[model samples]
Target chain A: MARLITWCYKNHWMTLTLLFAPLLLHGQVNCLIYDAASGERIACELSLRAIQYRQGSRNSQLLFDKAIEVGPKFAWAYYEKSVPFFKRGLLAEGVSLINKAIDLEPKNYLYYRAYWYFYNRSYAHCIEDLEELYTVHHESFTNTPGGEMEMRMILAMAYAQSGEVEKGIEWAQHLMDTYKEQPHLKGQYDHHILGVLYYLNNRPLMAAAQLEKQLEVNARLADTHYYLGLINRENTNSTLAQLHFKKAWAKLQGEGGGHSPNIFEGFNVSAQDIEGML
Target chain B: MRPVSYLPLIILLLTFSTFACLQSQANHQPKYKIPIVTHDLSYIPFDPLLDDPNFQICDSTKISSGRNRLQYAAGRNTLRSDIVSRFSPQSAYESFNGYIVIRFLANCKGQTGRYRAASLHLDFSPAQAPSNLEQHAKEVVMGLNNWSRATETNANAEYSKFINLKIKNGKIDHVVL
Candidate 1:
């Protein structure tokens, strides 16, 4: 009777082990083989890349949701996922996602850089990013060919957009004077900014000439046409103004058959209306 | 009997545990998100006259000069020819006076295929008009037809360059002059 009892106890415990062994192995693999947090972050990054490749906001949102599900702490996923929301004109969601990213990585320059642009709604954030990049690696700006010059131009534009017109103009002029003869930097963004500065200074002819030369080099630039059209319209050259307007319209329509609500509010004349006038 | 009985329970436990772990890990895995970037291209306008089929103009005064009109017609013809030749393949040019009118056709192959002229009215304008005016108009039409056929035959030899021609309301809007 003692031997039977001992055997029975051993058999019962063995049965329990057998019943639970698969669960133990599964838990071990989950803990050891796959790190949930890291996997979620990677998925978020991949989903963002896929969004760019696919050009569909829906796909991006789906991927972003997947990333968040996999890793709730993945800040980059939130940041990347916000892009589609912003693009789809869901500003509220974009703000939330960007805020979430900033919360996760408060000290990260990239997160701050993104927030600065999306929140401030100006080019200042780009300047901030450049400045931060310079701070992190001074040599990247100083030693690299054309890097310093490019950063200066970007800073000038940012300043201009930020309502510091005088400072922007001063920086632009300084760049032009320093790099006037430099083959690599001459006729770059400096010229464009200088043209804008001239227009602001009430020098229409000079502004028109500078913008025209830039347009010649980059015909597809919508902003150049916009400026040129404004100058021409102000000067009472309706034909020239109409030409620029048409060019701008074509470029904007090509983007997706709709004007960018932010930039092209003034020049949103319908094709039929223009034809009627013509 | 004891060893065999124990084997079944061990196998069952291992399989169940593995599945359970997998399910739990799946639940714990975090999700990922993507970032957005926007790239925009600028716009350019296209010429509207290139696609207009009825972009023709006629000059009645020159055609009325009769035999002397040939020189005028010839001059106008040459100018029209030059314009047609210079025009991109996707355009056409037609110029006319009362006594003489010239039409030139350009195709996608960058070849000017046909040149047509009409002088029927030139001989008919006077009370006693020349008998050959009908023949002259006929000749002009024949010449244009022949040229068009030749162009079609040699079209394969030229490089294909496609350009979108803008037409509005079935009319030619602008001439590059």
Candidate 2:
């Protein structure tokens, strides 16, 4: 013990890292994670213990698989193991691994799988996962996997993409009504999402109104400008349309148009697109 | 007599307990050093570049996963949209929706290098897109010229990029930049 203290005293930074690695790696000190393996509403202290040693990396991922072998019921290990596969473009392997997590714990991972379907632009597959979560299970997912966007809003967009625009509008309206009391909706674009759908439905007046409200809250998205431009163009207001198009181009230019994870646009506007509009 | 008998029983218990402690100590492996099996190759697989004969990586040593983009003027969105704008759709009305993932290399000389492409259906089952659609998907990416070279300590570096395109109804619907 004296020798260990001496070594730790010599290597202060390494000691600090060793002392606080888990909090640094995940920032989740609490075991609030759910593991559906036991078919009960319970937090996964077991899963946290399963991965108590390390988190995501080549070594960690292999360790996760070992943890799974040691405890086949450890659903979170499967989920953690699956993540790097998705990053490496092995969707087939990724989904297969996540499926083990989902089957073991649907309450936690259904929306995550749906997000992947959305990421892949498999609207039908996305809709299937979401509908099962909602209709069959009577569960409501408030946000996307990483909590960046609303899952119900994604459901609306999926419905819209699959040629059910009216159904999408209904879903969007429901999402807004259900979550209206919660301010910030976890920093998601509620009015912006609804505005895009409203424009798609040819409700130009409502679309314009909703998008204006969106801009009032958050005025940065290039897609919002692009949608507003399209709405203006449809209303035969060429001047406003061109102005909005220019603004959209400027946002793309100014913001560098980087796509953060879990954020998507209905219309991915380009330089030629803005120029053509102008 | 009773005290002597109790003493022998106590000694047997002490010996048994000490043997158990030694056995546990000898058998114990640190919980933290949980043995990992060799990582399964199928789970990780390989980057698409290794299989393609189209282009050789100009330099592999500096290959980064591209956390920093090679900055272009109009930015990532315009770059992606412009690439799609160059596409003359081959399978116009035929419904082929899913993903077109292209992994391409960028060298230190600000040039796009070798590429590998995969087309998948909505469920992520590999898709047999029309020859032209497949050809153009590869061609449009290979055609990219303007790449700002990655820099490491004020020197040029090489990197690879994943161009993940979301296709809907045989058209490029969204590009994840």
Candidate 3:
């Protein structure tokens, strides 16, 4: 190894290649894992101890408090301490704790804060964090922490929910276009959200086209058929609407449940909802 | 020159490896742990209580019916809308917009009570709304007598639910279940 080092030192090209290796690796790596310093990483272990106790219990929260005190810069401690507060309806306390964590390490904790923002029905705030995470910080996303749906899906859906249906269509369309040829790699119901957005935009032709593609990608997603049925009815195609609604109802009640309910889903057609339509 | 001239380079490469391996190790480990621990030597139990004096959790074991309980939740989304429609115009409160999260329990016989509530701004910071805002929400929630008693393994089961209401311009805009 020493001989190779000497040879590399002798050749400027070899020396330059050796120097660039770390930078090359850095580009390919997800920033969150490598963003922490070794000291903060050790501090996060204290949080692990806290979680071993029952969540939201006195002991667990105390341990989390201790972790925060001992490793004040360790963002995970603040993030961990905020969780129970969020779950138990202490939104202010939860938001304060998570904000500290995000301030310490924005890349890692922004997704979590955005997730609660979505739940709290603060669609604008959710969009702000996600837009920052995606556009400003350039963080690549796969799903929310709960594995419900892609963050892009959340972005597009939030746009629609926030009354920005045009932006929603642009974004959802962009996501589908990116993964169009690769069906398996698409989000669990990316096409469904797009189809719903199209229907909401009053473009029944595009809506029907997206729903047709949705049937091919995720036939089991009952909400897809439910929205498809609504579109068919809107277009005065009662026969197809009836057919789609029946499919939606059957798929909704089937053994596996066409699609397991997701909190982040753009649309969920409940049995009660379908009953009225049927 | 000695081989030690490259020591900094080697150390830099090793440091890079350390950063790469560290959090990925946490990712590989199963995060699931039995979370029902009663005590630990290092534990210092001190959690603030936000509950009515008469309220007590009926079951801790299945308490996490938690997410599953959401499936059987009754009148959450619907009742919230009714409260806004019936009560909003009558009360001349200050214009306020944010969330009101109410945490309470339902007992085995479909009895519900013990409400603890918090109000927050849209960005989720602590904020004050008109007293009537929270009062009206609590009244509607307490008036609800139709909650279904859900039991997975037994007939009598008690549970807790958090009802999050988003208020916009002094009216209940959305109910988050």
Candidate 4:
């Protein structure tokens, strides 16, 4: 009986060790470098920016690929890969990659943002993604007032573009009104919304004011000049209109600017004509 | 006689324990001596008159899983060389909504080299798939493979290894060497 007890003890010990072996053997896989101040993962953020800015899609793609290769389970890499695809008109691939990202990191806001941008482009599609982003990450924007303002401006634009012109106007007005009182938002009003609203309301003067302000703040804002040019042309200010038009054309040159004939028609401009002006 | 029988059993137990300890130690062993390489470039220039404003440099080396730090030195020269090689004057300012392929060689140990290819796919997110996504991917891979193979065949070549490359959308998201 004593020998039997000893044998059982030995077996029990071996079983315990075997069961815990894998857990103990698991090593730290990788370390991500991040900005300590922002608590933003440096590599992931840069990857996102690369995709967002369309700086080097090829390089960004490689970086994300490398990121995933190094950490197959990392959700951000998949999310990063989706952006360039979506921007370059590869919607299906973008959606698939974004879904993968959401699956891997269900709680991440970045994944949701990617999806939001996707559906926001077409109003008849998934509006829920935008709502989800607004609800889940409502607080993140509040912390960064500038970022919040920018996001609100984008959301307003998306709403307007999606054909919810009334709702878009409402959001835009809300952004302008809410931030108007704050000193921080003094110069950063909802110019896109303001421009769109003035245009929609048939107030060309107001629309031009808002858009011209946007251009002044950032000359590289090609879309602003494009819209301003449209308004200026409608107002019959040919020289100023031409200037704005020329700027838009210069900014959009060689970017497949006229690929979407539907969107370009509204501008009443042609790529060839714009090139001629340049 | 029974005590003598227990001797072999003890020996067997001790030997098994030693082997297990060695295996665990090997598995947890740290890589203490990894080779390091540094690349430096002066500048990456962009011609606003001819180059897309959105163009930026990417370091393909950073995509590796090894403990090597890769960086691209950004300035006028580097940018000019890269853009000049990849684009034409007529198409220089064209916004490319496609991927580019980059290849690198991995030198392992003292006298061995391995070729690696990475693919970049660029596109917007959260929508239905784009029409040209697949074709772009195929072209990127083909370009990388062609370049790597061609480089490998040339003697006294700048690049001696062949790495397979692929791109999906406009980004390079996969690499296999």
Top candidate by TM-score? 3
Best prediction by lDDT: 3
Residues B61-141 of candidate 1: C-alpha lDDT, one tens digit per residue = 111111111122233335334433433322121221112222333333333323333231211121111343323332333
Chain A TM-score relative to the true structure, per candidate: 0.46, 0.77, 0.78, 0.50
lDDT of 4 by residue, A22-135 (tens): 443312223345433332354455455445433223555665655555555556666656654443233445556676666565445332443334332333233344455455
Question: Residue A179, candidate 3: how far off, in angstroms?
Answer: 2.8
The segments of candidate 3 whose C-alpha lies over 4 angstroms from its true place after superposition are A1-42, A180-184, A254-256, A259-266, B1-91, B107-111, B155-158
The candidate maximizing DockQ is 3
lDDT of all predictions, in order shown?
A: 0.43, 0.65, 0.68, 0.43
lDDT of 4 at B121: 26
Segments of candidate 2 deviating more than 4 angstroms: A1-56, A184-187, A232-246, A255-262, B1-63, B66-100, B104-119, B126-146, B149-158, B165-177
Write model 1 residue lDDT over A1-278, tens digit each, in one string. 99977876756534444554443221211223335457654665555554564333345556666767667666666666565444432333455566566556544324333332422233545455545544454422221111212444555556666677677667667666755465433432345556776786788888888787766534554556666777888888989988877776675565423232222112223444334433
Q: Is the docking of candidate 2 incorrect, acceptable, medium or high quality?
A: incorrect
Question: Per-prediction DockQ, in order?
Answer: 0.01, 0.09, 0.14, 0.03
Candidate 2 C-alpha lDDT tens digits along B1-177 = 554568788999999999999999999843122223354221222357444444445444335554345544556666776788887776552567777777666556655655667777666656777666766787887777666643445446556566777777777787765
lDDT of 3 by residue, A156-264 (tens): 8888889999898887776667665754346556767777888889888888888798776558777878888898898899999999888888888873446526564
Ranking by DockQ: 3, 2, 4, 1
Please state the i-RMS of candidate 4: 15.1
lDDT of 4 by residue, B44-77 (tens): 2334653345434343322222111221234222
Which of 1 and 3 is the better model by TM-score?
A: 3
Candidate 4 Cα deviation (angstroms), residue A32: 14
